[model samples]
Target: MMNEAIARNPQIQSMRYSLSSRFQAVLLGAALGEILGTQCQVMQSQQPQVKQPSQWTSLSRWGFSDSTLANRIAIAPAWGRVAVQLIKGLIRGGGGETSWINEVLDVLEIPFEQSNREPNSERNSSEQDEGSPLPDFPQIDAGLAIAALPIALFFHADPHQLEQELQQADKVWRHRPELSDGVLAISYALSLALREQLDPTQLIAEIVEELELNRDRPTTTDPSAPSNSANFVEQLRFTQSLNQTSLDRATAQIRDQLSKSQTGLDALTIAIAFHCFLNTPEDFCLSVIRAAQLHRNPQTTCLTAALSGAYNGISSIPLSWRSALSRGSSEHSPLNHLWGVATEAELQQLSDQLLAAWSGAYDLVHLLNYPGQTFAIAAPKVIRPH
Candidate 1:
């Protein structure tokens, strides 16, 4: 059986190889989108015309935690930047414009090249986080979800299209012959779901239909095989036909678990589009859910529970990060110089806001998929320290 074979394959044994490569793709895409998203809308300006922090600090308006944003950008902006780059690459590859990513890059004064993709030949390359709790590789579902960047934000979208992307990603993973199917698919789910708002019930129905379809098929359906794509397309059509309330009921059950499992936004990132990037706060929760549903690992479930307990009163932006630029020197500051210098207190606040954004993103995802469901839950629970 392909499932059994895949599980035993030596290449799939380590998650490191797969996760790092995904970083290159997702970060590139996100960077491009962010640069374009920030163009006309008022968040913060690249440069100030006045002495007012209000004019210079557009991120303040969007509730950004400047200290945390700086730390994240410094620590692993490669993830976000790579995502932006990928979108630009995709655009250019398709013969579209590249100006969007370029604008953000120009303003931020960041690199035009992809940051994290270490050349395979270079022995120094690795997936390990620089002193963060998140794993270096896609060892867990939550971890994989985090590694997949913006896609995780889109999980609550229409499953038909998402599934296609997942399949394509899987195709690449399978060719590598070393990645976990459950791990990769979960990551694939998260990547597709990012930055897109959808109806929850619609998303749930589509997923349910997809599960049934996958359950009924051969593991290695050949692309060259007749009607393979056709059958997949039919599944999407079928899920869309479901009644609204039914879809909502199913989605509610899963969402409850997700809400319960959220611990913090330590893992979330600040996106140019607030909806696009979710840093890895307690990704292990979602990862565990994937492991359980897919029968992979039990910690995925435990992590989810742990995260839920930790996620009581989170704020998206840490106060210290928020204040770095909130009160600052009059000099024209280098982005890196201004981004640094955060107190522990500031980091905590930024963390809370990041969690809130993820929660908001999750809601939007469900809404986009299940256009018919009235699946409105209260806002994300925030956790603040004494």
Candidate 2:
């Protein structure tokens, strides 16, 4: 029965479905990003809303890194893994727990295992000093517990309960210092989505307020405005910055119309624009990409990463990007009895091939700004200390 359940898992099943071969093909395309993407962060903030998320955490998309929304769905998951690993690594290192963004790969190297270990670990720090490269996900219980929360939320026994927990977490996060920028972004996107179901009017109010703020408009001049100044209802919504008097009513209507949508990629479509506000504490550009995915938007990342991966580089794609370390044989596949996937070597080659073919941006703003276009920029920006 346990095996049956694991066999039925979506992500697990996905690896068995004919889709698995394509996944390798995609992975192959990604190799170019290892060298190409580091140059992407050089594209300075075209404006405030598009700025990279590594600065200060705020509701401003201007700070989003040049990571195109194309690859966000894929990147988000790795962030989930990395965030959990850091907390656990820190605890194991005797630093106890710190911010969610503390680097875990630096201090400890552990396999991504489900089993727990001793609280006061017997492992030596000398191992790190000896120069062993860190493994992807650390084998720490605290990290697993924290990392598992999002996964559980993704496939909760009761999504409503998880939503409630998320709401509570959001409130608690507002006052917590240890919370990372990625966590806050995840919280905000979740809040926006939850509000859509629980108190839709509140969502509208926020939308209206967000638009007004974007346009530098007085949300409500009337004295009868709701105590929550942001609760003002408006017929139009525009996230465009500064220029309220030029309210493009048609465009605002379109914005609201789009939000009402539940089509494929719509939520993530808006999410990429929304997540641009995130700011990670470390230089891990992948955290921001991961934050975009915590909301369950992977296809968005696939496309964006193909294009923007060249600029953003692999570092932005969390080190935990590989969900599976070794490509298990077909015996483990769901089709063990009926079919088989490519061998590990075949899969690796396919992964590299697919990555090399990826030419899409991971950031959505780029899509809005330039659709189906790829061009070289002036010399990429110089590196600065994190």
Candidate 3:
């Protein structure tokens, strides 16, 4: 059972409505960013050559990638089951070696065979021949951070409890230490922003400092390994330094200085940089639009949008963007095709359920209306372009 005292904590109780709105913003912003980022990439790649000026055709299809899907799983009613499994495993003296990862995979209905496959195995022979060692397990995809967002919000009132939950969840992809750190940073930032109402500059500074402190802690998978937060901290600091500049210049500077790789520290850096560069969480549309134009990694944009949205809340997002997203074409509607439901309406419901779950008010009624099974059935195994 959830800690009743914490559920009724004064801070959380007072801010319930605000937190609910932020949760909705995080999920909705992630989906919208994915859509816009995908469209931007498609547009750039398909630009036609012509002697005379002509209007470039835009891709009509728009959908979110794996990041938003993982977020859906994170906030699904089924996640309560995983929480129970974690407690049981801990009680059985399993420590951090619990089967929480398998539970999440099962709840998401992702086949073990598929999840275990090496993400880089499909790379061309030339790339493989470069002598880069294959990861012991599949590298932690950046999308996994999306799964940690709700967990962060759930434990926002208690930083210690939040860290414990994050540590347990980090075990799911222990091989990628940097990725885990990145996820933790994003979650921690969101929690503080919601609780403290910190501005972007203060939020980024606080997050970097927290991560720096975490650098000395031993990892769950490897007690001897040093914390991997250094690179992320450095990147975040750089991102903060760019706050005074225009979004375009900051983005271009980030693109030039960072590796645009959609994995490990680079991807995390990109997302954080975008969030810091915007510094104006209220302008969700401009933030996501800038992110989409930053690079080809839609996941980065999605993550940035999620973070920004968490700070700004759902009402801060532009109505135009929300309306446009909800009206996505039949084949490309992420909510309908990828999530197996109407987008805006369902997100609102999920956001409420997540708040209810954290508040210890989750009941059978909410579960029946939005069953855990819907998450597994609706989410696609893979949505990112190769």
Candidate 4:
């Protein structure tokens, strides 16, 4: 009788899915959140009354922003080394004409000729002058968070190693302590979730403590010094305190404390609050939508969705939403036009390569080796300090 009962359940007979699926979900969720959040902001501006959740259907076009683009770029071969070179160029006073910029543009598949064109003919003479420093990387603010995602996933099981890698990666942020801290907190939280150590209610407090410890330690031995204000930690605590209250009150509080300004700390706080409010993986879509409603900026919503999706495997993401995204027509889907390729199959392939690299079965070099991409080399194991 017990055998017969077990045989009746097909779910029990299915093979277990791989961790790669979760990684893919994380990226997909971030993309979806960005699309939904952007659309919500448009709706809010167009109409005074809030739109019903049901009004948002799969047919709606989802367009990804720079945040998603940066995330995709971060997945390229040897991205850390590329980031290091870019930072070095910045410090050396390299202008917009720096080779690193071209390298980045190449990897992103953006047309190199586009850089030569003036942003706008209306710009002041001084702005367009040859001496004027080319504007720093346009997406540097949220790019920190996006870059940290792959790093966090790579070092998910080792917090100590994760911290070390993050410290080394701080070169990308230069003197922006708050920005660096925001990225650190987000990456650490994602790491914990990946390792299944995340407790939504206690997550904020734990991260605060971790940041405090890192801050208190002297950095003379380190290449980059820590650069954060007390307000970042305090804000995190404030957000955590609201977890005991109703979601409505928590949302209202966060909306009041954080402005529409897309500051690094503000973005991180919003993501943390949404994660806590939802308090469960099953609430991923709703949490991201609420985050979007809280702010029009796509960064906060993208970060929130990525974190939630990391915690909840891809299976938990609503099939309807995925279907809507996959079936979006070119006329209705902004993603295809903006990103060039927006199919589910392409995303899955990227996820597979990333997962392979993370698992030591492949390295960045192997993944980037065109035509001979099938050849994989063992990834070097990350050694944690004793």
Candidate 5:
């Protein structure tokens, strides 16, 4: 019955009505995007070395085979797993701290010993192509963006806390200081979405400005290693300047320019993700489909979907995708055992609880003895929906 209610209205009316919807959208959207993107990546990897050019059309209608869907269920991406951990940590009152992030990583089975052996091992890996070969090390990758989702949503109302918390949480995975810029850029985008202030036309410029402002601050990246922030900012600006009407054409033009430059994969992933979202900011499915088919990097798709999801809310996502995810949950599913979520309903509950925590109403549900309660507390003097 409660699940049915959520299905009817996932955005439980609270002091901040749509805010609850955005919370669920960010988590579930990122997770669903991760799944779809991974499936596409797997399919792409299996393709023959030589590929043929395809028509300029959206592959949003691409069908996933049963085997592919089953495979996706078996192996959730590390970023998605970490994202779940981040959500859980926030609900538990954990905040921006290396110790707190490390504890979360430890629970997720990250091998700390490997990090010790490969402090400077910077190679493209599975979870993210942006940074080190070690899974534990921070790199300018999509995983960091996804992992920062919780902090971004939890502290969406406070820019200072948002930046500070993201910076601290990112410390657990050491990498080039540019990683901070990437994480902050993603978080800032989401924060804007949650605040209902995201302007797609001005997002790139705003992020570039934000990145430039933080450059003077001390960084965790090696000072000897030249900062990639400027280059990324330039790429983003170039991407934003394209006035093409067709996504395929724009993607081609942007990809051509990026190929001629020295932009790192981390930067490339973020740039493309932004491009896809900015192109179809109003259409979550279209934006995510383009990311999945074009970028082919799970992180790119994940980030794009997350941004779109936060902006559009859960209701904006395709009902088919939402239903499929809800049905995928099973008692023995790896998603349950590993991510601690057995169904879409559980994920929604987690989002509600996080909102409740953020609203200073952590005890509301318990106080009301409503284990299945979904509404989050809203502060006084805030607008409420009729």
Candidate 6:
């Protein structure tokens, strides 16, 4: 069964990485990006919605070092939770809508009926106190792009299915069309990475072409806001010109371009993610850290880290951060739990299951667990930590 599944998926066979390495990297990188990026987010807030923890008082001084504060703090972003649920939906539901939707809403503690209802703006403000859970469906931003990771991975070989699944998955947010564009761009980029077809020089161009093509679809086109594609395209084009400059200079250029284009927050965040990734395509740590520091937006940083991970594979992530992710405790720690994945081994298991589903090898877990079983997927190279 394993050999037949592998035989059917020639795309993975030709790749430079093992299926497990890329899958684990994407999940781990996104989680780490959120851990570090949200710290920056919290530090930037002068009057935070939740009380600031004392440990983070010196965040500015730590500078996102590999062995420092980022590994110790586990701040789970909404995107990580959403990505996990999406994985469940794909594997268990067989791409069915209800399974994934319920999985996602269940984690957020929101019922399917309540998903469509707008939050009561006039409700008591005290309900959002420190002890309260993060709100379901927080404002749609570039970070939400990470939630579509499963769709990209599962449907990378099928462009039509990839686009369709991405759109269906995005509808849960009830966000603006522009936000959907950002999600599509990020998802498509991941799909390209998984196929080993991603070219740093041509990534922006390809994404812009995809956005334009999607704009032609009746469901995505906004006749009233026709300039949506044009605006995003302009911002993305500017990123392509960014060379191997310092993170500060690259961030400044991104800010200047956004100011000149007068694009929305989602656009700015997506642009920042692309700029950070393009500037340091080979270094996952540097790319994600630059993203986190870019205007202190967790979503931008998380998405940037995800793209870097997909491109570089899991071996590229720093050892200290990987150790923290695998060993971190979930008790009172939001970062550790991504749909019951509190440790590195659990996340890797989930990734393997996802790969099994994608490859049509439903019994992969059984084969992998039994020492007597000899089934193994061949790879071009063995992945190892740097």
Best by TM-score: 5
Candidate number with greatest lDDT: 5
lDDT by residue for model 6 over 232-320, one digit each (tens)? 56666666666656556766876676577554667767877888898779888777766665557777777887889889999998886
Ranking by lDDT: 5, 6, 3, 4, 1, 2
Q: Which pairs in model 4 have colliding backbones?
A: 177-227
| Preferred candidate (lDDT higher): 1 or 6 | 6
RMSD of 4: 11.4
Residues 81-129 of candidate 1: C-alpha lDDT, one tens digit per residue: 3333333333223212233333333433544434234667333334322
lDDT of 4 by residue, 245-347 (tens): 6656866777776654345444445445345434544577666765664455556766777788877768767776666555535433433432333565555
Per the 3 Å backbone cut-off, how many clashing residue pairs does candidate 6 have? 0
lDDT of 3 at 92: 35
Q: Give the Å shift of residue 262 in candidate 2.
A: 30
Tens-digit lDDT track for model 2 on 1-386? 65676465533333221222223322321221221222122223223354443432331132122223222222312322343343233223322133222243233343322223454554634543464443333233112222322222221223433333333222222222122222222333332331222122243345444434433523222222222222112111232221132223423433464466433123233333222222221223443343232222222232223222222333344433332222244344211111122233433432232222222214434432433354322111212124
Segments of candidate 6 deviating more than 4 angstroms: 1-14, 44-77, 97-138, 169-175, 220-229, 244-246, 255-263, 326-328, 337-340, 363-386
lDDT, residue 109, candidate 2: 42
What C-alpha lDDT does candidate 5 achieve relative to the native structure? 0.67
- What is candidate 3's lDDT per residue for 128-193, written digit by digit as tens? 466444333342355566555556666676776777767764444345666666777777777766
Error of 2 at 284 (Å): 22
Residue 327 CA displacement from its true place in model 3, Å: 2.5
**Per-residue accuracy of model 5 over 219-272 as CA lDDT, tens digit each:** 554444455447667667666665474666766776677577653657667777
How many clashes in candidate 2? 64
